[model samples]
Target: MAGPVTAAVLVIGDEILSGRTKDRNIGYIAEYLTAIGVDVREVRVVPDIEEEIVAAVNALRVRYSYVFTTGGIGPTHDDITADSVAKAFGVAIDVDPRARAMLLEYIKPEDLNEARLRMARIPAGAELVPNPVSRAPGFWIGNVIVMAGVPTIMQAMLDQVAPKLQTGVRMLSETVRADAREGDVGGPLGAIAQVNPEVSIGSYPFMADDGRPNTNLVVRGRDPAKVAAAVAQVRAMVEGLRKPG
Candidate 1:
């Protein structure tokens, strides 16, 4: 039994909860992580409050193998993600030299005001996660990775961070169609699933050519051989129940 690689996502902003912004990061991260064999087990959306952000960051970082946070790292007064995450880890927040240098490379000295320099503040002893879309870098403290909330920037940062993560065996899926009603095949499908506890089998009903209900059974597993074997078992079971015209 291979241990599952788990991850959690924290979306920090009042805009999301207040319905002012529809979150696109969660779905994008979920799909991206799944493709790389990491199971995203939990997701949380918290307001811009410091205590709430700190608590959420602390709890998720401890619970998951990897924790990803998005939003609240901007120049606005509400951007307090860095401070909150630092507090969560009991670390000091300061303007990191590397981050400062990066910002200075692109931004003029006149533009590097207190507001913009806020982006340079990172948790002590944290490593920088590259933000190709913008010079403002994200930071990684322990298992928690802080990234930008903007979808494009988040994706770019993920490209840099994803390779560093350890992954599990990729999940495999197999599908087969049966000219039978879902109700008719439900019992056998459940029996097959019980017999092969390692694989997950799902049956979806659809209309057939003859206007009768048919089912498409899908088997998924981390092991390709196991998935194929389970699919065969389901196919055999369904074939056995086929009626002669």
Candidate 2:
């Protein structure tokens, strides 16, 4: 890649905003893309409105290397993501023969109702994203990729789309768990972070399953050497701050 590979996610659904549907695709997509070396820098959620979808899609597609949208591709009338994506690219849309064929693999010819065929409508000049879970394929035009909102179906589409994306260096991470509190180590951790500008350092305090308070210090960077070096300092700091029982 010529530059850092980056992406953004656009989540579309009134149900999600209304709390009727809890979103599960964003975190999965983020982790999946990160593992493949594509940094997900931003995420936006919009209602079922066509204008909002268009605005989010257009903005994110230009700002990132890839923009993946989840939801609004079902048989119901509220599924307007396809048309909104088309509007974003200023392209005309129609029921694609190939998409209809995919649906036929799942739906019997006699059962292929008009509502079901609505899933086949795709933007002009866009390529189809195969949906192994359901036959209703998503489509992509330019840098924007549209996928189903359902986690399983969206994951299947991501697997299909992954090979086509341009990836970057995978980030390296190191975690050091200490029997310490965040406030007890925040000062030294902050100093370590200042010296290691290349790596990101964080301190997380949580109640362990055993009901004891503990801290986890994490270091992340594209360079393994830097991550290792920074984490070494983190371990040293934790050890030096240890209290005698």
**Which candidate ranks first by lDDT, i.e. highest?**
2
Please list the Cα RMSD from the true structure of every candidate, rounded to 1 decimal place: 3.1, 1.3
lDDT (Cα, 0-100) at 174 in candidate 2: 81
TM-score of each: 0.86, 0.96
Candidate 1 TM-score over all chains jointly: 0.86
Per-model clash counts, in order, read: 0, 1
- Tens-place lDDT digits, model 1, residues 19-108: 999999999999899899888999999999999999988888878899999999998899999999999999999999999988888799
Q: Which digits, one per residue and each the tens of the lDDT, describe model 2 over residues 1-245?
A: 85669999999999899999999999999999989999999999999999999999988888999999999999889899999999989999999999999999999999999899999999999999999987889988999999999899999999999999999998777899977888888888999999999999988899998998999999999988889899999999888888565
* Superposed model 2: Cα runs more than 4 Å off: 243-245
Indicate the TM-score of model 2: 0.96
lDDT of each: 0.92, 0.92
